[model samples]
Target chain A: MNLQVSRFQFFSIVLNFIIYSSILMAPGITVINAKQDGWLSMLLALGVGLAANFLYLMLFKKHGYPSLFELMDRSAGKWIGTALNIVIVFYALHLTAMVVRNLSNFMITDVSPYSSPYIYQILILLVVAYTSYHGVKNLFLISELFTPFISLFVIGSLIVIIKHFKIIELKPFFYNPPSAILEGAYSTLGFPFIEIMLAGAFLTYVKRKDKLVSIALSAIAIGGAVLVITVILVIGNDSAYIVARESYPTYSVMRDVSLTTTFKRVEIIIGIAWIIGLFFKISTCFCVAMMGIKHLSKSKTFRGYIVPCAILVWAMSNGLHKTFIDFTNFVSMDWTLYWFTLYSFVIITMLIGLARKRA
Target chain B: MQDWKTTMKANKTTREKIVLAIVWGFSLYYIIGYLAGIDPFPITVWLKAIYGPIYHTLFGG
Candidate 1:
C-alpha cells in the first residue's frame, strides 16, 4: 500500500533480476555466435540495454508514480489496458517458467546428474513462491541478506580464475565473421539486458520518485558492466570453441579452478552463488506475476493467488517448450523482437503522451 | 471514536496473526524439511507431471 521501496532494496531487486541465467550462459552463447569478438558484442548489448533503460526512465518521469497497470490504463483506456495487462502477465509468467526450466536443465547437466530436474524445479519454485508470498518487503530483505555472500562468491571466483588466464587465448579477436558478431549482439541484447522491461512493473514501488531514474539507470549500468567483465574473463581464459560448447561456460570456468592445490573444486562455491542469484531472479518474476494478477482481479490482497499461481507456473513451464536450446531460441528470435520492442514502444509512447497531457 | 478504535485494533491483530501463521507454516513446511533432508517427492511429482512431457517430447528420451 505504501508503494515506496528504499534505494538499496531497489538496487537489490534490480541486481537480482539482472544477475542470473544470462550471466551463466551469455558468454558461451555469445562466443558461439561472435567467436573471439563475443566480449565486444556483450559490451554492445550493455549499451543497448542502457539505452532501453533511459527510454523507460523517460516514461516513468512523465507518469510520476503510476504502476505499469495504471500507466497502461491512462494511456490505452480500460479495454486496451486489460488486454495489455493480460499479454504482459502471460509473458511474465512465460519468462519466469523459462528461467526455472533453464536453470533446472543447467543443474541436471552441469551440477549433478543424480538429481531429477523435477526435484530442482519444485525446490526452486517453492523457495520462490514462499519469498514472493511474503510480498516485496520480505523479498527485498532476503535479497539484501544474500547480497553480500553472492557478491563475495562472484569476486572470489574471478580472483581464483585469474591465475589460469592465458594472454594468448585472446590473440585472434576477429576470428568470427562480422555478421556473426552482429547476430550475437542481437541475441544477447534480447536476453538478461532487454528483459529489464520487466523491471518497470517493480519500479513503481520505489519510494523516492525523484531518484527512481538515477537508481534504475545506475543499476542497469553496473549490472551490465559486471556481466560484460565476466564475459571478457570467460572468453580471455578459455578457447572460444571450448567456451562455446559448454552449457554453463562461467560455471565450467569455475570447474577449471585449481589455485595451488588449496582451492580446487570451487564449482560448488559458484553453484551456491548461482542458486542464490537464480532464486532472486525467479522470486522477482513471481512477484511481478502476483502483482499482475492483483491488478487483473482488482484485489488488494495478492497472497491468496500464490499457491494456485505457483502450480500454474509449474504446469506452464512444462507446456511451453522442451530443452534449453528451444528456450534460448525463443528468447533470441521471438521474445527479443516482439516482447522487447512492443514494451519499449508502448512505454515510450505513454511517457510522451503523459508529458504532453501534463503540458 | 471508541468503535473506530476497536475495529482498527481488531483488524491489526488479525493481520498480525495471519502473517505469523504464514511465516511459521512456510518455514516449517519448506525450509525445515529442506534442512532436515526430507526428499521433496510430492512437489517433484507435481512438477514432473507438468514438465516431464515437454522435455520428453522435445528432447526425446
Candidate 2:
C-alpha cells in the first residue's frame, strides 16, 4: 500500500506503548520490592531507561534511519542479521502473548469471571491482527483517535485518586534496603524501557528523522515520569502491605475513590483506559512484527501471515495457564533480566558497529 | 534477489484469494465464539498445551 504514517501518529503509538503495560501493575510489584521508596526506585529506573533510549538514538542516528532489520544486516553479516531477526520476531511474539494473557487474566478475574480467557485472547488478537494487517497507517490512525481518550482516562484516574494522597504515607521514602531499590529498578528497566528496543523496527518508517531522537527521548521522559508519579500516588494512598499484596494496586486506588458515595467503584474507568492503551500497544507491536516478516520474506501481501501469527500468539498465551502468580514471577525474574540484557547489548553493539563502519 | 518494487507488483491468483478467505473465516471464529458463547475445543486445548510447556520451561516450576 506504500502507506506512510505521520510523526504525531508514531509519537502516539510510542506513548501508548510506554503508558499501558506498566501503569496498572507496576505500583503493586515495585512496592513489594521497594516498600515506601518504590517511587524512588521508579525514578532511578527512569534514569536508566532514558540513558538506554539515548543509546538507541545514537544507533538510529548512525544508521541514518535504517529499519532494525536493515541496520542489523548492514552492521552485522546477512546470516547474523537473519538470526537476530528470528530472535527479535520470537521475542516480540512472546511479548504479545504475555500481554494478551495478562489482560485476559485481569478481565476474567476482575470484570467477568464467566468470560473465558480463550475467548478474550482470540477476540483481542483478531482485532489486533485486523488493525495490523491493514498496515501501520491504520494502526497509527487508531492510536491517534484513541490517544486523547486514553490520556484523559489516565489523568482522570490520577485526579480521582489524589484525595487519598497523604504526605505521611510518603514518609521514610528512602527506608528500603539498597538491594530492594536495585531489584525494583532492574525489573522496571527490563520491562517497559528495554521493550522500547522493539520500536527500532518502526524507525525506518518515521518521516522526520531530525526529530526522532528528541521525540523518542521525550516519550521515555514523559512516560517514565508518569509511572513515577503513579507509583508515588499509589504508595501514598495505600499501605505498603496492601499495595504489595494487591494485583492491580492502581486499580485498587481507583476503587477507593468515592466523591459523593454515588461515584463508587470507579476502577472500571481505569480498565477502559488500560484496554485502550494496551490495544494500541499490542496492535503496534503486531504491525512492526508483520512488517519485519514481510521485509524478511519479501512478501507483497502481509495480510497473508496475520492469521497464522495471531494463532501462534494465542497459543503461546493460552499455554501459560490459570496461575497468575507463576506468570508474574516469570516476568519479574527471568524475562526481565533476559530482555534488558539482550536489548541493551543489541543497541550498544549495533551503535558501535554502525559508527565504526561510518568512520 | 528481486527488487521490492517489482516484487510488490506481482498479482495474487485465485488460489491465494481463496486461501485468504479461508484464513479470515477461521480468524472470525473467535468473534462468533465470543458472541455465541460456544467452545472451540481442540484449538483451545492445543493452545493450552503449547503454552504450558513454554511457560514451564521459562519459569521452571
Candidate 3:
C-alpha cells in the first residue's frame, strides 16, 4: 500500500516532533547553563539547527536519492548499507525507549510521585505500538489532528502569563560568557533540532517535495520561537535559579499561573498537551524504526514486528538508565553528542556516495 | 556481489524472524532479570562507560 502525507500534515508532524519533548526540559537545561540569557542560547541553537537542516536537504537533493538509505546503499555498497540501516534502526528504537522513559519519569516525579513509572510505560507503549502498527498515516494523522490544541496550549499560556512577565528578568542580556551560551546551544542542538534529520525517513512519502525544505525549516523556526518564548516566560515568572532547578520548567510555568482566585489550573491542559506531544514523538520514532526494518528486510509489511518492537522498547527504556538522575544527566549533558553519532554516519556515507558519482 | 535487496526478498521471512527472535531475546533478558531483581547483565554499565568520556569531555564534569 502506498502512503503519503500532505505538506501541511508533514509540517505539523515536524513541528510537534520538535516542540513536545524539548519544551518540557529544554528551558531548565538552557537556563541552568546560560542563566538569564538562555533565550539567546536557544536562538543560537535554532539558527544553527536550521542552517544544518538546509545544508542536509540541499546535499541530499543534489545527491538525487529518494531516501538516505538508498543514498547509503548506492554509495557504500550492499553489506555496508545494510549495516548502516541496522544501526539506524537500533538508534530509532533507542529513541523510542528513551522517549518512553522520559514520559514515565515525568509522570512519577510531577504528575503522581506515588505512582509506578512502569505502569505509565506499559500503558503508553500499548497505544504507541498499536498506532505504529497501523503504519505512518495513522501516526501522522494523530499528530495533525492534535497540533492545533498543542499550539493553543502554548499560546494560551503565553497570553495568560503575560501579566506576570518581569521584563527585568530578561536583563543582564548576553552576560553569559560566549562559551557558556554556546554550551547551552550545543546541548539543545543535538536534541529536537538536529534530530529533525529523522524526517529523512518520511521524505519520500511526502506528496510535496519541492517546498518541503522551506516548509520544514519554517516549522522548525516556529518550534524554536516557541522554545525561546517559553524560556522568557519561565525566567520572567521566577528567578533563573529557580527555573533552572525545576525539573519541568514549562510545566512549572503552566502550573504556577494564578489569574484569579480559582482559575489557575492551566497545568492540566499543559499536561494533556505534553502527553499528546510525547505520543507523536514516540509513535514517530517507533514507525521510523519499523520503516527501517521494512527497508532492511525488504519486507512487504512491518506489522509482524510490532509486538517485538514494543517489548524491546519497553525493556530498553527500563534498562536505559539506573535512575532519573542518570536519565536526565545523559539527556541534558550528553544526548546531543550521542545523537551526533548518527549525523557522523550520514556524512560519511554521503561523502562516499558523492565521490563515487553514482547519480 | 549478491544484491542485498534481492537477497532480502529471497529470504524475507527468515530475515524477519531472525530479527524478531533477536529483539525478543535481548529485551526479555532485561525484562526477566529486572523483574527478578537480578539484572545479571546491565546495559547501562556499558552505555555509561562509552558515553562517560564523551560527557566529561563535552560538559567537563
Report per-candidate DockQ: 0.04, 0.08, 0.37
TM agreement with the true structure for every prediction: 0.82, 0.85, 0.92
Among these predicted structures, which one has the highest DockQ?
3
DockQ of 2: 0.08
Check candidate 3 and list the clashing pairs: none
Per-residue CA lDDT of model 2 for B15-56, tens digit only, reads 455545544565466434534545433433443454546545
lDDT by residue (A99-181, candidate 1, tens digit) is 88888888889888878888888999998888877777888888878888897888888777787787577667777777777
Ranking by TM-score: 3, 2, 1
lDDT of 2 at B54: 56
As a TM-score, model 1 comes out at 0.82
Q: In every candidate, how many clashes are there?
A: 0, 2, 0
User: What value does the lDDT take at residue A54 in candidate 3?
Assistant: 81
TM-score of chain A, every prediction, order shown = 0.94, 0.96, 0.96
Q: What would the TM-score be for candidate 3 when compared with the true structure?
A: 0.92
Considering every candidate listed, which one attains the maximal lDDT?
Answer: 3
